[model samples]
Target: MIRLKSPSEIATMREAGRVVARTLAAVAEAARAGVSLSELDELAADLISAAGADPSFLGYRPTWASTRYPGVLCLSVNDAIVHGIPDGRVLRDGDLLSIDCGAYVEGFHADAAITVGVGDLDDRARHLSETTRLALEEGIAAVAVGGRLSDISHAVETVARGAGYGVPPNMGGHGIGTKMHEDPHLANTGRPGRGVRLREGMVLAIEPMLIESGRDRARTARDGWTVLTGDGSRAAHWEHSVAVTGDGPVILTLP
Candidate 1:
């Protein structure tokens, strides 16, 4: 069943979202060419713990995965799209690293992701990351009390495709609250007027994952976790957990 959050519950989620936002910001700032992905993950873990929140991605076992997730953050570098495990791999000067993470606090959960360039990047890398981030902003703006759910999807799709980027069909956002993933799976591409009608108390994680230069599809690695671009082009992902309110669409995951 699709769950609606109360104002008080949303308030708690807002706190969780703050923890997530702060942690992600810290990780992004700490990312450097010489740092390993595991080091960044560790930094996020400590930040989440110090804030009295738990890492939502740690040991999370989705039904589609072969085993429990082992990282605090999904650090996807270059062609790796999402769910990229953190290890000893050192970042390079021109790599694009996608950091996806979540935080849980007081029984509520918030999820968000960001793709950043490790150092000096080419035009394509900067364009892909910036375009993907813009798509997420447009998707968040689409949330309205009486609008259809796919309105957000359409907004995201339009921004991505118009920029000549490709979206991974299987990897998208979802409803988020007590659980990291919930009912009403949200695709990046859909008809605007279709799907569930948006309600005042509904909260969703709106994310856009765009592949480099319009390839249209990506591939999953053998780990049954990491997603990859098909044409060997770089990819970028951006996300935010948002709530539909009487006032407007309020982003919970902001710092």
Candidate 2:
């Protein structure tokens, strides 16, 4: 069932969302060349704990996963699209890094992700990251109170496809509330004016994962966590926890 947050409930979620936003910003700042992936995760864990919030992704095990997620942040680098486990791997200059973060506070949860280049990036790397960010902006703009859910999806697809990028199949956004993942899966590509009708108080996480290969094919790592582009082309992801309101879409995850 789709869960809608009350005004008060959304307020609580906003608090959690800010926590997530702050944590993500801190991690992104600390994400530099020569930094280890595990180091980033540790920084995030400490920030979340200091805020009296819990790391939403830590120990999380979705049905499709063979093991619990072992990191506070999903640190996807280069072709690792999502769910990249944080380990001893040190980052290098010019690596495209995607950071996915979530936080839980006062019975609510917020999720968001961002992609950044570790250092000076090539033209293709910078373009891919910017396109993903703009796709996220388009997706969130389509989250009108009375609009259909697919409107958001189509907006994302338009931006991504227009740039000759590919959206990974069956991997996009979702409803978020008390639990991290809720009902009503939102695909990154869909026909506009279709699917569930939007309503006030409904919160959605609109994330767009793009592949530079212009193909949807992808593969999961042997560890059953990290997702990689099939042809080894680079990928980027961006997301925000949004709430449908009478005025318009409210980005809860804004810092």
Candidate 3:
């Protein structure tokens, strides 16, 4: 169901969103070329626990996955598009990392993601990361009162498509609130002024996953969780939880 949050509820969700933003910021700062993905997960787990919140991603079992997710965060690297488990892999210079995190606080949930290039990244990786971030910002800007959900999707798709990037068709953003994923799915490609209409008190997570080459096809890894580009091209993802308001759209998970 699509739930419209009240003012008090939105305030509480802001707390959860802040925790997500702060956690991602800390993780990004600690991430280095020599660090292991497991180490980053450990740091994020500790931070979430210390803040009196629960790691939303840990133990989450989506319908398609064979087993529950075993990590506190989704750490996708290079060709890994999303849901990359944190294991024994160590980061290397010029590697692109995509970190997706979620937190549950006071019974409310907030999710966010970011893709960054490791030390001494090449120009191509840098461009991919920046474009993904800008696509997210543009999508968020389209989330306003009386606006259609496709406005948000169109804004995102235009930016990525115009840049000659491919957006994965199967995976896109969605509503976020008491649960991690909710109603009113947000696609990256769609006709403007279509889909559900935006209204005050509605919160949505706007995420754009862009592929560097080939079509929008994706495949799951043997691990049963990680998603990667079928053509083995590099991918970038960025997201933020946003709330529709009378004034405009408020980004809940900004640092």
Pick the lDDT winner.
Answer: 2
Worst 10 residues of 2 by lDDT: 138-147
Q: What is the TM-score of each candidate against the true structure?
A: 0.98, 0.99, 0.98
Write down the TM-score for model 3: 0.98
User: Where does candidate 2 clash, by residue pair?
Assistant: none
lDDT of 1: 0.91
22-107: candidate 2 lDDT, tens digit per residue = 99899999999999999999999999999999999999998988889999999999999999999999999999999999999988
lDDT of 1 by residue, 1-255 (tens): 789999999999999999999988999998999999999999999999999999999999989888999999999999888999999999999999999989999889999999888889888899889999999999988899899989999999999889988888777889998999998899999989989999988899998999995887788888878899998888999999999899999999998
For all candidates, what are the clash counts? 0, 0, 0
Q: Which stretches of candidate 3 lie over 4 Å from their true place?
A: none
lDDT of the candidates, in the order given = 0.91, 0.94, 0.91
**RMSDs, each prediction?**
0.8, 0.7, 0.9
Instruction: State the TM-score for model 2.
Output: 0.99
